[model samples]
Target: MKQKRSRYIIGIDLGTTNSAIAYMDTRKNPTGGADAIRTFSVPQLVAEGEVKEREGLPSFLYLSTGQDLPVGSLDLAWAKERNFAVGEFARIQGAKVPGRLVSSAKSWLCHQGVDRKAPILPWGSDMEELSKCSPVDASALYMGHVRDAWNYLMAGSDPSDRFEEQDVILTVPASFDAVARELTLDAAGKAGITRITLVEEPQAAFYYWITDNEENWSGIVGPGKIILVCDIGGGTTDFTLIRVREGDAAPTPERIAVGEHLLLGGDNMDLALARLVESRILGEKENRLDSLRWLILASLCRNAKEKILSGGDVQQVGINLPGRGKGIVAGTLSDSINMEDIEQTVINGFLPDTRFDETPVRGRGSGICEWGLPFVADPVIPRHLAAFLKKHAAEQMDSSRADGRFPLRPDAIFFNGGVFTPRIIRKRISAMLSNWFSHDTDPAFQPLVLENNSPALAVARGATYYGMVRRGRGVRIVGGCARSYYVKVAENRAALEPGQITAACVIPRGMEEGEEMEIEAPEFKVL
Candidate 1:
């Protein structure tokens, strides 16, 4: 028996807040080209019993109580008698019933302290009747939905065209550790996608930029130039620095550094806006809102934030919180969020001007702590960026700088993520970067912005292009392990102290895939 050839190469962007799929027909494009790649519109339940197509699927899952909707409302063409929902409808309905909603699964998947395989999602929920799932389970559900949707729309009656049989590339955060990466692979395997390759989200975004500018990318970026990839998504912020060096044919790009995983992004901004509105509506003396009500308010604030930052003419959006009793309309609490509130709360709060040497302030931890997803102590994005640059300055510093006093200054910035959709927000971040550089060395130095055609879809599209590149199609960015590894060694003595253990570098940073290195360490004898 012979194996069937894959008809397509697919890329999946399993984002924290939303997910997207892109693919290229191998049969159609024997010789791959960036123009041949296309985005797939996913069919999902938009409302009860109604199915519609959307470009991106919201990464939220709602576990139904079997009484929330009408019969056959949750049914899909691929499955029947369903008790759960994923995508747009899930996000919309879960906002009202926060106890049953599984959100930020990606963030929880990377959390080290918690058992990712344990059923602890909908964290801190007290609902006994509702079913709970693990962080890995939530991710697998999302991936399985994409697989079913693809088979239903593209496979037709041909079993060979199923998504599981295709060459797939999935994107993950660059800062994710080995445990997190392994968990992600487990989720994909559970979804029936065993043949898959994982790519860093930041690198995928850079690949998309290269494919988008294949004609003139070499002209725009020459040798010895550093490009900073700033990725601020719904639930996480990632920073990567890439350097362009001269190659045999054209300039080659190499990834030099990646920042630590910081759980701070649009979700944090939404919560901040919600708190601002809550304070205005309920006075300081009023009782605080319960957990359910707080989640509902945050959802409403998310909608308002999108509207205000959408570059529309609307100045404000109204928020109406439903009461728990029968007379809901009469007991409803109402408030409005204006453009001013958005600017003061989200823009000024997260992305503010700061000096290059200034570090992010770490808040004091309480004696009694709670077990949950570990969020960043400081929410200032600029401060975090400054710290990332300072840490990697020695390796990426320009040869012209002999003083070694200034941090690594990027020649250009490539912004990718939904958080950077608004022109005002992008300009604010650019201005902040420019201010920091001007104060450091050159007064006229300003990092150029590499225009992204679509920030929301870049990762998926880039992943697909990378799949093609693996098949001998396009240029590949040289990047491997994001961080170095170390092993603890004890001192050879008759009596050892508690503080005598030291770590030896086993694997150096930037070691490419498939590369081997010899470690010189004493061998231990087992009894």
Candidate 2:
């Protein structure tokens, strides 16, 4: 007798700082129960000969010298030895030599000016002797590691349990442009993920919400209600607004708008803290931090910041700053992240409460600009939020949307990222949102209502559920691409005509992808 084929769904969260994989067996849960979803504990080396399993894989890669290690030192159970290291060991050890560490490759993928496929990562570093890789290559390495982990889990269990046989859902930032998305898809392809689909990270988070709430989701959310997903990862902050649409059976979620790509998040905060500590150390002296030492200190600041934010009841943290010598610790620099520091640095500086009409202010332009990642000059998060809402909620899009009202605001907010681990930041953002909502009515309403319990792993979980939904099992979010796409319309007019070159929107808001549209216009030379 022939054996029945096992069907499984895999979800991969390709994050900026950390990545994770989750899987579910449709064969086990034919009824589409959320409990079927389980996280895959990825096997990676935490230290030399100390292999351990972690829930999420740190999205980092370390170029190895291959001198001080034995054969198979960098090999996983399913993967052979490679010159580079990934996960915990890569993150922990790479901190000591940041020049070799390839971090924030996801951010680099979105940069337009740089050649993504070229080996230019570990950008602007003086690691000339060592080999460097492209952003796409870095992403593929992480995905390849996750793929190996999945295959390793199913190796002895079932012959048909290969990742190639399963449907995969890969999550990306909602703000990622077309090129970035394409690069991510290509990266997954290179990583041996055959059957895959790309879902926005914010949408994946909301899908997790749906799975978590289950039958109760319909009760909590109704038609016409908007939910804002605020995703602040290690490298970028993404905001996506999803509106609850009318449905016959259940309320369908439709993504209405996505925020601008802001290269400001936990990494920026870490850099700020590093600068603060550096100033304290130098005390306005002529001495400045060298590149290597500055890199090490930045890594330390990241670690210390995590401790201060997540470590409850821990008043202070200390870092043994390294000096210019072999195996030498200069001094133990201890500092407390006081409430005032948090307020002044993060709340006031990054997310200051602003009115709906307000927008982010541009700084003075410089003559000579540094060539690197494009960071947001203005740190005010509210102003960016306001701008996104205003831009998408314009009355012009009313013809394409179910709700015609301008200045649309979300009824609930979903927070996802390590930065939101502290209750203080969440509360501050909630207060700012409420202040914006207060302008509409006499009695103020709190718009930030939805709270995600598993902020760290929600994207992976939601993506797993999304894979199930793709197989016609669970509830599906209805919106396709969030933004309206347009093609430039060229007109045959005289010179100096302002309306000669216009744009014709080919894809309307909420239109599902792969839906073909025929545009009726005067045929000009296709540009």
Candidate 3:
């Protein structure tokens, strides 16, 4: 029996802080070009009883109490009688009530320390009798909301045009391990998206670049050029290196290395700014903020940071904190943050300029540490990049060196994620990289910046192009498994004595998809 092809190919970028959707209609452009892709504006609840369309849906969920809103205020166009909300309204209202909000669910989904399936989100909250959801459930709810939004706007009365019935591709971090990838698939399944494929977010960004410059991509990036994809989003920072190969007709890109999963990004910067604002508000007072108040202040700081870094004429944004008193207007606290605060806290503190040999500082660990997401101790992003380059130096070395001791130098850099949206931030990073390379290897070597049209939404659009590439329509980046698979084996020893355990590599790194290998090891006797 012959099966009918899907009408549309959809791409979903399930980011840590935001999510977006893009699709291509196969009937309109059968050959598939970058111009055929279209971004879908999601319709979500912006406020109580108010619905609005936004390009990116904030990845946040708010569990509403019985008295949170008026009757029938949480109703959407597709569904009614809702007790919870997921989208802009959730982010806005959840800021006030942090105990019931579920933010950074994507980061929690990949956290192996906690049970991802257990209802433990809103971590470290003291509100009792409050309904809670697992990380997997929160992620599923976000995806489910995206599916419903697409169906409501695009599907209409035609069942065949439903989002779930179309071909879909989802993007994940290149550094996500096997367990995290499995949980992402589980979340998608729970959202009723049965048929789907997973593409690394870094690869998707590169795909978008290729799609956007399909005509002169070869001229922009030629063979022997190594492009580094630096993706720093709200909750995670991902790095991937792609080397261009000399093909007969066109230049081919191959993924060389991927950095470790480092849970550091704009969220850390928000916390830093919050602390700065807190010091200003409480000025020399010993009285400290409770957990709930601290969370509220942090949310307000995030808003301020965004406004200041948005490259607008506004130099300062006012932040107000609700008082603990019975009256709403009495005892309210207020403060303002200017551009200097952002420069000192986010730019100088998080992304400071350092030498290429400098590495991230590791603080001494205590025996008993807090149980939560394992964020990087040192927040300096350039130091981490230096360390990553040092680790992967053996992969691609500078041929100019006689002894071949020089590190891998990137010919160009492609920046993605919301953190790089600010021009100052991008300029600082570019200057730092150029300084490092020019001082060490060549005097005139400068990395070319591959301009991205939409830094925040590139992953989703790139994922859509990747879907077309899967159908043998566009250029494909040859990236298989990012990491290698290993197994622990015990050395030959007496049964009474302890055996020496060693890690044995079963599958080498960069193993292509659908490739298989058989392990040849001696069987050990069970003691």
Best by lDDT: 1
lDDT of each: 0.86, 0.78, 0.86
lDDT of 3 by residue, 1-527 (tens): 73466889999999888999899999899988899999989999999999999998999998887687897898998989888899899999989898888898998878877999999977767778678899999999999998998899899899999989988999999989989999999999999997789999999999999999998887898888889999999888999999998877778999988998888888888878877877887776665566677778888988999999998997999999988644332367899889999999999998887888888888731111222677877789999898888898875675663234336778899999999999899899888888877744467767899999988779999999998987888988986788888877776456435545666787888887668977666554688
Displacement of the residue 289 alpha carbon in candidate 1, Å = 0.8
How big is the positional error of residue 183 in model 1, measured in Å on the Cα after superposition? 1.0
What TM-scores do the predictions have? 0.93, 0.89, 0.93
Candidate 1, clashing residue pairs?
A: none
Global fold similarity of model 2 (TM-score): 0.89
Question: Model 2 scores what on Cα lDDT?
Answer: 0.78
Question: What is the Cα root-mean-square deviation between model 3 and the actual structure?
Answer: 3.2
Clashing pairs in 2: none
Lowest lDDT 10-mer window, candidate 3?
364-373
How well does candidate 1 score on lDDT at residue 503?
Answer: 72
Q: Measured by C-alpha RMSD in angstroms, how accurate is candidate 1?
A: 2.9
Tens digit per residue, CA lDDT, model 1, 234-297: 9899999999888888788899899988888888888888788778777674655666777889
